[model samples]
Target: MRKIIFLLFLIPILGISQIELKGVLTTGNSGTDVWEYIDPNNGKIYAVVGGNGMSMVDVTDPANPVEVSHLTSVPGFDVKVWQNYVYCVTGGGGTAQIVDISDPANPVIAGSWPSSHNIHIDSNGYLYASSPGTTIYDLNPNPTSPTYLTDIGTEGHDVTIRGNRMIDAHGFAGTYIYDITDPSSPQFLTIITDPDITYHHQGDFSTDGNYLYICDELGNHPQADITVWDITDYGNPTKVDETADPSATPHNLYVIGDYAFTSYYTAGFRVFDISDPSTLVLADEYDTSSATGEGFAGAFGVYPSPTTGNIYINDGSGLYIFGFDGLLG
Candidate 1:
């Protein structure tokens, strides 16, 4: 009884010592993508959730996110915002759900393209969809519809684009980098693989684009390390740093400046300082669960809104919005 009383007292103190939770907003169900877009017309940011069809959130008020419109029955898997329109795929259902967000409050289907697991867009309004292998499309000619451009015979779980450089995390097989300077014909640059990097779940690049930070997932247990690599040289990726949580599996992550906001399935949200490539310092953490021990039952995705540094996360239960106090020591 004495130990129990002491532990209960320590819990709140530990929580208070960690990061600040500004506010959390959730969806009707679990959502994987928190797609943010700035209204070219008004400049107010809206978060489009990809889960059950889609949910439009007014994140202009980041603290109190309100779901103004949603399509709960469609069950969307991934989404990418382009030219004020949303291109999404119905995960297992296979079809693109093109939504027009010009109204913000009420989104209507603009059109549909090839459905995919993951969708990546460039500043040029071109798109790369991970339909297992990659299929490139041109949304420039028609914002409502896409004209198929090309397809790359490669498969991946997720893909990220920076400039003309693109990479696909193929899971267990590692990642492949590509030169997409010409969307009509994307050149495969190289494949990165490491014994510890099997099941390359998700990855993001450093602000300068010289480094690639990749994280393994729930598939390859024990290989939970969020491994870092030096990608200055295209074909050769050199391993640099690695970090992990013994109790939880790391999921999606987004970096803003030198800070990394990562989600640990059972452990909740974590903030890391990546200013120094040699060492990763844990800046703050917020555990989403009070249940004993751990095993994949908490936050799975996190999005750091570009307009406002406020962070948003979605667990299996609901969506949460948080405020990040920059590198608070």
Candidate 2:
């Protein structure tokens, strides 16, 4: 009887330890960053991949992704979607362009901007371009043709929108927060920095908007690559927790509910349990690369679809689709 009880206990523990994102499908052969677009008219889903150029892939079936369109003119290093349009920035600091995906089968360049490294669009349709700094644009009346708004002087690597606040990951300088409640007039909040910070690469806010997670691109090998900050006091942020892996370098991290998913360069896709902001635990991981080390050679981006619970990872080789049923709770 005691042996039976012990076996049952060990079974549950082993199940939890083995829990991870199961690979659902794999398609394509090259991509940099990946973002999803859900058509409001037809309710079909699509994946915008960034790499050699912009590639529009129909992901409605999730398991079988088909390349619907490709725009080779616009260099796609980073990508984002807003409504019916898709925004992409060229690799190695080229330029930003808006692509009309109203018809996913025939995507066309709608507009273009000056040299930008990354781009983002908020819920209110404000476009934030990281052209060495943060350049704001209004996409209200015309998303295809954005109107220049203003510039927030900071060496921005990436910008994220949380409610009415705009957070800029300013590489070596750290993170900057601004009140974008007024799209044109942004009010400076405060800068969050720590002595250990090497490069503030990308960031995302908690679902409840209480904590901020920053991924340091250069911090590697047993260093605090992913830092969690308490942003309840917007003006004065506090470092609450941090985590890292010795084998991989941190790139981008996205917080969805209680879990934090990251695109670890060589380590592939990593998931952390952030139920407690003071202490983060690595819950699961999926290696998307055969090579592993503290270098940039693997996964470049990880996007979790809130609508379908499908995890999308773009690596040096191609795009991977995974599904995690843990989000059902």
Candidate 3:
């Protein structure tokens, strides 16, 4: 069996300040899958270990992150945090584990839901989970005990919730929209399926909810590109722009203000300026050639800390925190 390794090297530019690497958190286990989330209220970082279960770390001190707690309830493959709670979905498990991290150092398992792979939460306190199907849970009644509202089966790969609308990246099923004003009974609004496109992996919406950035994971195909869609009119979505990079297959994306951060498999992390939704321009890119793996090695996720002015990238190796100075500006 071959081993995977991440070689860290810094390149300095005369006029441009390089993004500083704050810390690297590794489990010392080979082939460990890690996903991280930062609490908006506090600059604390939390990560879930895919291969060896989940681990929570207090990254308030970026230089030295302390491992606060670890839960082996299920091998967490994906994680999403909203408010003081962290929701994680396991790889082969049929249930999703919900943890109450109000006390950051001491996290307790609150509840569990069946059949979940990916999840997203809205400002209104609704938990949207995705597996082969999509399910919605109400988190306002009780933070610890979630109320199962409705299960909207739609072959969802990933879900993003904004206001009353929930966008579903339905793998080969394309992107579907649902109106969940009434949490218990969601209405299927529309389905946007373009045959010219390949697999729609993961995406995020603009803060104003005017546009959406969709990433297609099927790079071998010509249709693989980061597509920008105008969703001002939820009933009718229009493709604004589509851009592709020759070196990578975009798996997931993060949109903050006018900048969009993309995690590209094999090609590394690429940054694009989306000041104009219809026309996106490449601003900067960092190649992690050393982070390559056999299957899904490259870059899996990117989390930009709004408070610390730092960006964290997760490859197969571990969670790496980089200070984005020149990259964002």
lDDT of 1 by residue, 1-329 (tens): 99999987996677533466766665454557666777888878667776667777777776777887887545467767887788878654356778888887888887876677777788898887774777788889998888899887556677777788887777766788888899898888878888766577778887788888887885444554588888888767888778866677777777677777888777788888877754567877888654323455677667776666557676666677677655332
- Give one digit per residue, the lDDT tens place, for model 2 in 1-329: 99999987896566553334433334553558898988899888777888877787777786677878888888788888988888878754656788899998888889876758888888888888874788898888788778899997757889988789888998888898888889788898888989888888889888788888888888865678888899899767999898877878988888777787788988888888877755678988888888777878989978888887777888886777776655544
lDDT of each: 0.73, 0.80, 0.68
Model 2 TM-score, all chains together: 0.90
* Model 1 misplaced stretches (Cα beyond 4 Å): 1-19, 27-29, 219-221, 289-296, 325-329
Q: Which ten residues in a row have the lowest lDDT in candidate 1?
A: 288-297
Sort order, TM-score high to low: 2, 1, 3
Score candidate 1 by lDDT. 0.73
Residue pairs in clash, model 1: 24-321, 26-319, 53-75, 172-199
Best by lDDT: 2
**Model 1 TM-score?**
0.85
TM-scores for every predicted model: 0.85, 0.90, 0.80
How far residue 27's Cα lies from its native spot in candidate 2, in Å, is 5.7
